[model samples]
Target: LIYIYDLPADYNARLLQYKHHALACTWRGFDAGNHTYLKDSVYAVETFFHEALAVSSHRTFDPEEADFFFAPTYLTCYMWPVHGWADGPWYHAPIPNPRPMHAANFIDEVGRWVNATMPYWSRRGGRDHIFLWPHDEGACYMPSWIYNNAIFLTHWGRLDADHVSGSGWPPDNYSQPVVYPRFQPLDWRRMYKGHLCYTPGKDALIPAFKASNSYHRSPLVGVPPVKKDVLLYFRGDIGMYREWWYSRGIRQSLYRLAMEDKWREKYN
Candidate 1:
């Protein structure tokens, strides 16, 4: 059974503390519709977990009788107010200036407070504690002291050598069953094979937001099925072809290959 810490009122209060920032102005032309408007992956999961624990039979209020401790705080949601600005399309927009130092500061202060006020944090140096850091930036920005010791639930599970080398995170520090934000369009039939957002074995994809506009339902009136004509379809940008390890070299090559006379005739 999990022993969820009854965090000081202030910790959970931080969500309401930054309510204005969370609902601040977004780019003018951006229209993801009401459904996808404020639906961020980190925020979605954080909310679900909080609600789940609130009603779960497995949760224990007593710290001494618990097997593992849960630290419930919406750290990412708090950071979103400062980092959530957008001037143009998200793909082209630069990230907001001055990375969220508040997140790190919040974690540090919480760690200190917990250590001073409770015996659990110091019992085994937080090895038995769990922290949910779903946002990529939040996971990356966590202070070394807090990140190194606790079990972190994150979405940056693309556990490659580069991530390990850059973050200095021990390979074993993260657990499997990566939790990501809900996908838009709740229906699987509407998703293309190549465009599917998740990795099969490594991820546990959550449900789409109730306000998601990605899902569409056709009228139930009887209608003939439309005939299929096109054999292959591709859309979206080819991305900048650059000489970097993460550049779109493969995409560039595919575009080049598709431009060849024989391939064009075969597909087009």
Candidate 2:
């Protein structure tokens, strides 16, 4: 399951092209350089595969891991070069589409993949770390975000099913409600204008999109890309700003959270 920030008009057709490109590259052999690239590809394939890949089963080797394991990293976006676009530092290809693959369908795919390949995630002592945070604030680590939103929740719940029975592992299928929040018409248009940096001129946009988290300390901070831009403001940079400006309520909550020292690891 792939989590996308934006869906273009021709998203389905474009994805088929990406799949074709990826498949063609499969025959290329891996090299020493690929290993170096993998180290920065965010965990060199999920850590769960450390054991699975070591066993050398031809069929079950997990191509997803292998593709990620040897995928290249560039200071610039290198994901869909054939599409004639360069994102910031992150690299991700669009999933082949039946178009608009909803969250429910994606979650089911995640459950099947995890259960079939890493069933051990549900057994013994390897529970807590079964999931990896996929969003990495847009960089070589960006997969951390996509992976988290796409597969982590499903896998984590599946792994912890014994403790949190029916804790929403495979999301309710057949009942996906289109619940994307309605954006103000003007606001939505601005978002589609492509990647822009966090600066005072765009300060008004902050309050409109701000989300609070212990991971953030400053009231105003730069957030990563939710969509791709043909041109990037910063070379390989995803700059987000946290604002203590208008949302005094959120700021106050953060202050109390800070006073209690509830999120030291994240803030520090």
Q: For every model shown, what is its TM-score relative to the native structure?
A: 0.51, 0.22
Clashes of 1: 1
lDDT per residue (tens digit) for residues 15-111 in model 2 = 3344324322121224656641112222122222322333444323343332112111111112222223322111121332111122223323333
Instruction: Tell me, by TM-score, which candidate is best.
Output: 1
Q: Candidate 1: which stretches are off by over 4 Å? A: 21-42, 82-97, 158-268
Misplaced by over 4 Å in model 2 are 1-104, 116-129, 136-268
Scored by lDDT, the top model is 1
Q: What is candidate 1's lDDT per residue for 56-81, written digit by digit as tens?
A: 98888788887777788766555554
The local distance difference test score of model 1 is 0.49
The per-prediction tally of clashing pairs is 1, 17
